[model samples]
Target: MERIEGSGASQLVQLIRAIGYNSEITFELATVTSAPPQLKIKVDHMNVELEKDDLIVAQSLTKHMRKVNLNVKKKASISSTSIDSLYTLTLPQGSGEWSLLSFGLNSADFKVEEAELEFTDELKKDDRVIVVGMNEGQTYIILDRVVMY
Candidate 1:
C-alpha cells in the first residue's frame, strides 16, 4: 500500500477528524458513468463526486490509511464543552480540536490542528486519534501513523 508521509498525512488526518465520529456514517466506491470515469462517494444519502484533484489525493491517503490498524481496544467518548460548532478529542496526553463543514459529502471539509507533542496511539489510553468510516455493515477507524516522529 502507498504510504502518506510528512504534511500530507497530517492534512489527511485533519480531514478525517473533521468528518466527526458517527456510527451511522457510511460510504461506497462508485464509478461515475460520465465522459471520463471518475470516483465518487455514495454517502449521507447523496451521490457526491470526488473532485479530480481530491480523488488523487484521497487515493494516495486511503492506500496508506487502510494499512494501519484503526481498531482501538477502548472507544473514546465524544463530548462538547462549548456551544461552538467544533468537536474536541480529549486524550490522556492532551486535547485537539476540529471543525466540520458539510455540503452533502462532496463539499465536506474539516479544519484541524496538531495537538500536544506527546499525543500518540502508542500511549495506552482510550483517547487516541481515530477516524471512523462505515460501509454496508462494516465500520473502520483510521489511526494516526507516527510518520514524522
Candidate 2:
C-alpha cells in the first residue's frame, strides 16, 4: 500500500488536535453599568464591554418576581396529644402550594416552602454579576448577581 504520511495522515492529525481543543470557558466578574435586557456591562479591571445580544441572563434577573421552586424539607416534632392539628404555623417562605404533612405522634412532621420576589426594578447600574465566557469569549452568559446580605 501507499505510505500513510503521503496520503492524508498530516491532515488527520490536525483534525484530531482540533477535537481535543477545549472550549474557552472563563468566569469573569463584571459590573452592570446600565440596566439589563440591554446591559452595558464592563468587565472588572478589563477593557471588555460584554455585548447584550450574546448574553444569557438568568430569568430571576429579568422577570418581576420569578417563583423559586426549590425542594426543601423541614421536620418539627410535637410531643403533646392536644396538638392534633397545625394552624397559623409560620413557614420559612412560600408562593406555591406548599405542604406540611403530619406523620404520627412519634414520627413528627415535614414542611415544604416556596416564594417569588419582584426583580424588574432590581438589576441596575453598579450591580455586580457573574459572567461566563464561552466560545472563546464571543458569547457571555450572565449567571447571577453577586450579593451579600
Q: Which ten residues in a row have the lowest lDDT in candidate 1?
A: 119-128
TM-score of candidate 1 relative to the true fold: 0.17
Scored by lDDT, model 2 comes in at 0.65
lDDT of 1 by residue, 10-102 (tens): 656545545664547632223322221332322222355333333322222232222222232333333455555655455565565444532
Residue 77 CA displacement from its true place in model 2, Å: 25
Specify the highest-lDDT model's number.
2
Q: What is the TM-score of each candidate against the true structure?
A: 0.17, 0.46
- lDDT for each residue of candidate 2 in 34-110, tens digit (9 for 90 to 100): 78557778876578677678788877777566556544345455455565665454456664454454444444455
RMSD to the true structure for each prediction, in A, is 23.8, 15.3
Top candidate by TM-score: 2
Error of 2 at 43 (Å): 1.3
